[model samples]
Target: MDPHNRRRHPTTTRLPYSLGCHACRRMKVKVLYPRPHYRHSLIGSRQCDEEKPQCVRCTKGGRMCPGYRDANQVVFRSVNTEFIPEAQNSHLRKTSKSGGLLIESISSTPLLTQPTERWEAKAIGHFLYNYSLAPTKDSPGYLGFLSDLLSKEPSNRQLKSGVLAAGYASLANITGLSHLKRSAEKHYGETLQSISMALTDPAEASSDTSLTAIILLQMYEVCYLREMWQSFHNDHSQAISDITLVPQDPHDKGLVELHRLRGNSPSRTAAADGILHIIHGRLHFNSVGGLHPSRIDAELAFEGLNISSSQDELWCIMREMSESCGKIRAIMSDPRRNMPESAIIQSFDRIFAAYLHLLRWEATQSLTRSYQSYKMFSREENDTHQETFPYKYHLFKHIAHGAMWIGFWCTTIYALQTLTRTSSLLDVQLLSRGWHQWDFNKRLRDAIGEICACVPYMMGDVDQLGLPMVGKEGKAIGSFFLLRGLYVAICVEELTDLQSSYILKTLLRIAHVRGIKLALRPRSRWFAQHGIAT
Candidate 1:
């Protein structure tokens, strides 16, 4: 099959349906438009371009101007620079008010491009910029033109995704504890605005929007929680002087999760919940310091799980899941989770479905259905108005196998704040090219395997043009799977202080050859940390 034909297939939206193939999947591809090269448009020189792009602003005063001129040529030449200004394609010129020669808008948003698989590296840049770095105004798709390309009368030549997603990611990337705190606050407002939009869309709204809104709200909640803890820390300097640390039990099986995933049964001997047990036992960073008494209440109440673990530098390989009831597991029930990705992406759709039910005074019924683990007993009272969905909505089964992939990305972002450059973090599994250690590489491969496995489900037939699962409803199924791959690749490539950048770059090269959507959120949380307020 011709690689180009695969780009427009509908099956691309859902994960694999029946068989799994070892294929290099694509996430996004960016095509940088060439400059007009007309004397006046000289932006700046390459050396001065990293902090400032060579745009009209930099070239305002010409040769005698203080800053270097001819800067916008780009610090690196990676995209297809060949210009095809042939007469037939001239319409693109009129759209941009130039000779069909328009510069891509500079927004901090990471926009995915067609044949997305090609630009895997950019995705990593986005992950690092959005989650690891401090916030800056331009840190997130600071290019500024990304969001404008997503409407009814979308830009004829504009290329990118909406501002919110990319912008939100950027705010997460900013560095510095103090600076990060402020970026979170400012972004909280933007997220609040998105929330407001979801609240009003009675028919236009679906499970995806509502859930994402709630998650964003939670992001704010987390920031507030951190602020509260920081305040407490400032007020109680000597409260933890006598903290007693405990050691994890070497023999504890009942403490394990109610049911182990995939394998293991009641009779199977299991490893003690050592991770949890040890975490609970430790009282201080160093044994000499002992443990703080204030944390004891928090610790015991946590039932062996530590709050610090939430902040633990996230590693790709997990022996067992953190309380199955936490975030990712909690989100699997989202109505949008069942919805197709092509329909419209609602990163928090699961949460939205739950919120809508809550709004109608049916919080239990709503949240119950949306909760993946919410198991209710069959009762005669089941016959209620609860079964009905507004004319615009339908009960859709959210994809499962695909979600594990998404879980990985969400997990990565959440972990970035935790794993520091010096922590005993093992990020080698993040390698995109391939790792050689049998066990470690196996872990990474398993994650990628799940992602590629879902491709058939999203797009359906490798031969079909329209993805059957997506249908005319505007939803695509496998999006979560692909995003997961992008998320992990991005983190491994750029976010984590991983030493092997080349592996991810190579994986992206494979994506380009295979033809997948390669995209990045240009404006990330980093800029918010660097330039904006919380």
Candidate 2:
């Protein structure tokens, strides 16, 4: 038999050898396999010129030529035959052809997969690794507490599910992945169901895991609301009620205290020592001084502060200024009698004096010292900022600056609002003389500018600044500052339409990017009213 015929059998088929172009083999089809326009110099074919635009043969044949593949292109093929690399094949024992090539000889053994619980544990472990220290010292630190609850024997399923939900929600925000958000929603639903069921059993309902789970559920809701606009339902009220039934641990007591504070009901001791005394002092001053006190001890104390004072003294001045604001508000809101122009002017002078004092105190402090103190405190508080991630320090520093900025902001606003109301009650010419000296417009602009400066810091981007290592506390604090600033900026009549819109949009972007639900609702409302898409 001929050599080619000997290689063929009844079970196999052979095609006649033809020197075709590489494109034919790549396409692996018989019909028009060697396309008409394909440039190929077959052994028996005519040697046609391969020209750009179109080959000579293709042009003569009136066929469109498809482009050719690159010379260095690599194609991969699949085969059932065993052909291990020489470096790896040396370990195999020599054997008969059938035995050596058998699929079983080179096949890998099936891996024993871990159970679902182990996999869940692994995922939970990963989440804790990232978020275990996320909460600040002042916060409840529910994530850290959840880590402990997950590590316990038998495990708290409700709490674990809540943690998983919150973890995935946080991850979704960080990564901006839809699948993780969906996963978070699923686990959140499961957590709610579990908590409802657990509530039936008294022992289970009052457990720390149950309480932590409730807090985590709240966090999950916050994350969910950040991405979408929804009505502000008080989900936390029900949780607060449920918390009353729980046995009082330190965490539980703290929750109860927070619940009371948020509910506008101060603890009896705090009321006695703090707010009640302040109210009493304000009332006493009003009764004696006839709507405007000639001498307020708080205001006098602030006026006496020297430039060479410590932060503690400056803080005292701030407190005095804050109290003076409350007194001014009380005087303005008094329904008993109308305030005289003389009294209003006197009150304005006192408040304005305190405001100037604060400004002077702020000026005396070094920006470098403030920045350094902020960095040092932040590094001490958050572990995420240690070595691997240093930029997070700026975010925390921004938050610290926010706290100070808010103080200046509130005082400036109070002074302006009080002055506006007082001016409305008096002859414009009479008050204009006093107001012109203060430059209220300039003061308001400066305050708004300071708040705006905080925007880049809060958003975790300032020139070549580091990425934010923002955790729950940072987000909450930053959102609060921005929201307050937005409110202040929106209320200012001095701002032009374009200026207000710019501030509003920038705030909206920060809220959206940071997943701040509280900031989102008001921002979305403003956007809707102004014909801007959220």
Indicate which candidate wins on lDDT.
2
Relative to the unseen true structure, what is the Cα RMSD of model 2? 22.7
Query: Which residue pairs in model 2 clash with each other?
Result: none
Q: Which candidate wins on TM-score?
A: 2
Question: TM-score for each prediction?
Answer: 0.21, 0.45
For each candidate, the alpha-carbon lDDT, in order, equals 0.28, 0.49
Model 2, 21-96: lDDT tens digits are 3333344423122324653533224433334455444555567755444322322121212223321343444456
List candidate 2 segments past 4 Å from native: 1-165, 170-222, 226-350, 371-403, 426-434, 463-484, 528-534
Candidate 1, residues 42-111, lDDT tens digits: the string is 3442212212223233244342223222312223333221322222244334455555565444334323
Task: Name the runs in model 1 displaced over 4 angstroms.
Answer: 1-213, 216-398, 404-436, 459-478, 489-534
Worst 10 residues of 2 by lDDT: 285-294
* Number of clashes recorded per candidate: 125, 0
